[model samples]
Target: MTKTALSHKSASPWLEDMRRRFRTLPFLKATGNTVFLFIFFYLYLYIQRNPVFEVTQIPATQLDRWIGFQPWALALYLSLWVYTTLPVALQPDLKQLTKYGLHIGLMCALSLLIFVFWPTSVSAAVGPREGGGMFAMMYAVDTNGNALPSLHVAAAVFSFMWLQTIFRSVRAPIWLRVVDALWCAGICYSTLAVKQHLLLDVIAGGALGAVAGWLSLRSAGRGKIAG
Candidate 1:
């Protein structure tokens, strides 16, 4: 076979193996779902403990920290900001949708779970504060039970980390990755700038997203492509 055809065949075995395991490997098939369930179970038990919000602070007085533009932090936060889709858009397929859903569910559930033991703050300080357009609304609707995990940031970073899929599937340019990385930074800053979350919250969110994204992506198997 030619090099191109040989390469394709080489790739096909791994793809076939992954697809076959989807049936034989229940854990593989439902890794995302399993994660979602654990997170949900954790939250279910956690509520009995009753979470509370505590206080924390942003590091900078002049606005803009992340330890003065922490690289990964900036990339994760900005990618999330640019890529977040509106609720009304055309829905993704079941597999992709489930991944996204599980990511969100896991973040929110674990965050709430963590809060029961180690509560953190909604804002840097407890006070009457000026709020922005969505900020006030988010604050009002936001549960006082959990704020530290910054589920929004977690979800954002989850999607950002999935950027590789976009490139792999579409043959996207390298600049796209760079753009997504920049968005990650913006999303993190926006969390603090908009008063949605603190620095610690951003860190926790990024970490959670990283783990969940890794687990979800590792198990995503593709079916055959017609020649």
Candidate 2:
């Protein structure tokens, strides 16, 4: 019961609790993901703004014409931020959580590399959106040159693929799974409806996301075998 020992023993419960929570898997995963996102965003914005790389416009296919402009889809499109992060917070264990984080980081890195080598932009087919609102604001900041691999679509597809297993493990109802699929589908379509990406961009991004998700799951499976 030395003086310094007694003082340390009486440290505030609030501070102790905060420290404990920050050590949890969810908190650490979130912090790491946030940092990665910030760095990725900086690089992405830099590429978009760079004037040296010539922008290649992706042409619209017949399907792109059928999709049409649905300015309303913007809501679902932007929901990607939530959908992408929710699963990480709900992760059941540190081991699985780490795997998911690895997958996401790899996917983002691969996309960034592609953008550096081949700077592609959405075609002017849809032209400039004609009003002032959320959509307009998005257009203002979301410059061209990030097309070909639609990160938005990739994220939505990735979220859907990974979260499906989580939800099923929790015994969520069939209806919930159906809604999840629909939401992801909406996000994929939103990329086209708003003309932020062409049909080809969505396809390529989806393929990339699926591959990443598969590889991540495979790695987790191998870990279980080793254990």
All candidates: TM-score = 0.55, 0.82
Q: What lDDT score is found at residue 142 in candidate 2?
A: 84
> Model 2 over residues 123-172: C-alpha lDDT tens digits?
57645555568876887778656897999888888888776765655555
Per-residue lDDT value at 128 in model 1: 40
lDDT of 1: 0.53
Instruction: Tell me the whole-model lDDT of each prediction, alpha carbons only.
Output: 0.53, 0.76
| Model 2 poorest ten-residue lDDT run | 13-22
| Model 1 Cα lDDT, one tens digit per residue, 69-176 | 232342343444336541101112445555556555656666666766676555434234354454445445453335557766777777676654544444456786
Off by over 4 Å in 1: 1-82, 86-92, 122-128, 131-134, 143-145, 221-227
